[model samples]
Target: MEQVPLNPSRYPTVDYEEVMNSDEGVRKWTDNIYRWGFSLVDGSPATPEATEKLLERIAFIRHTHYGGFWDFTSDLSMKDMAYTTQELGAHTDTTYFTEPAGLQMFHVLSHTGGSGGASLLVDGFAAAQTLYREDPDAYNSLKTVLVNAHASGNEDVCIQPAAPFPILSHHPVTKELCRVQWNIEDRAARMDVDAATLVKWYDAARKFNEVLKRESMERWFQLKPGSPMIFDNWRMLHGRSEFTGKRRVCGAYINRDDFISRYLLLNKGREEVLGKI
Candidate 1:
């Protein structure tokens, strides 16, 4: 077996042969490569049907409001719907939800015109760790505070009331600490903190965002006509670099537990084959 990089530029391309014929091999490969993130077989013409197959092969399929067919041209009205536009800042998808999807796959069907619209991915776990080491107090404050976020203009747009979640959390499967904060624009005012502490909290968060933006902790790539990028939404936060060209894509979400269950079941099958199960 070849050695895996600490951070791979792109996940190794494995044909269905490697993934289906030997469950053990697939488990071992995905475990290591996707510890932080991974991508699947690329270079094939991307389509909604192909995307569904890729997702079904792994485990249960999940969805958000953004799920299903979305055309960048006709969906101009959705631009204000949060995360509908091609221009997006670094954020974990649907952090406001009580239970955000653990994994996300974005399939790009076409990109006609776009300059600097490359997808940006940052290691949120790594970034949070850095903050914890440098500014423990700020980190603790974020974890303790309850963040409120709601869509403006549309009253029905407000969702799930307010929920308290740590900016940093332990991954339910990997047990690694990961960053969870998303949607900075809709964050409600902090009510518990005094004026001084609130100011400090905002400042710390601002600084962290700035550092994350400028830091070299990101890997960039443009989704070609036939490739889909699979990401660990809990551990990796993604965004677009902003582009004017027409970009059409479909996205779906899956839970972390579902991913682990599928992965472990495959591993068990492998172990049984090896007489170790």
Candidate 2:
């Protein structure tokens, strides 16, 4: 089966109350992510504890240097740029990890005395597919070239993958596009390729970046109180616009394997779902 990019105008949004109270609602919410890569739960409580509980219902929270569940404001609380008022380019998180986070949730608690903090999402699968169809050379470069990424914001703490990985990854058996890892900020500068290959890689990567930033490939929305958004980190690249004022956000990362396991069990007996994995 082929994967089509989401219809931007039709992004799923289910009621939080429904999800918390009914099994069918939970299946709908998770199914939306399985089919479209993201979904939103409206009417959720806008608090760190509430967010944590909601995420636990879906999968286990992945703990990193920042802890399992986090509540932070744009006050430079951490060494990462996400702590400041700046425009973050669209990219996936935890690129430095050998197994990057599977899913991410974000619920904006408050944004006062500020203007723009719109959330941005670009379907990496769509962009990569376009690259594959239009420029095979560039697509192949990204799929084959191995690169490094890291997280060194904490004092005396720098973490990176045990080995370098490629930007585009496919399923081993199905040969279907499964994961995408392209973070300009987190990607390290080191490479082992020759000068010619390096030049080709950069050119290819630049082209892919252009595709990712195209207007048709991007979706911009303001994450509001009572609306918690969850997205497949492996397929969607997320970012935020430059913002002012105090913006507090609460969220957590759910392990990929745990999420898939939940998705599989919830949709059991459906061959279409069970056969894919």
> Which one is best on TM-score?
2
TM-score of each: 0.80, 0.94
Tens digit of lDDT per residue, candidate 1, span 36-146? 465554554467776666566676687545444333342555435333444677888667677777778777787775555778777776677777788888777766666
Which pairs in model 1 have colliding backbones? 113-245
lDDT of 2 by residue, 85-182 (tens): 89998899999999999999989999999789999988899899999999999999999899999999889779999999989998988988899997
Clashing pairs in 2: none
Each model's lDDT: 0.65, 0.88
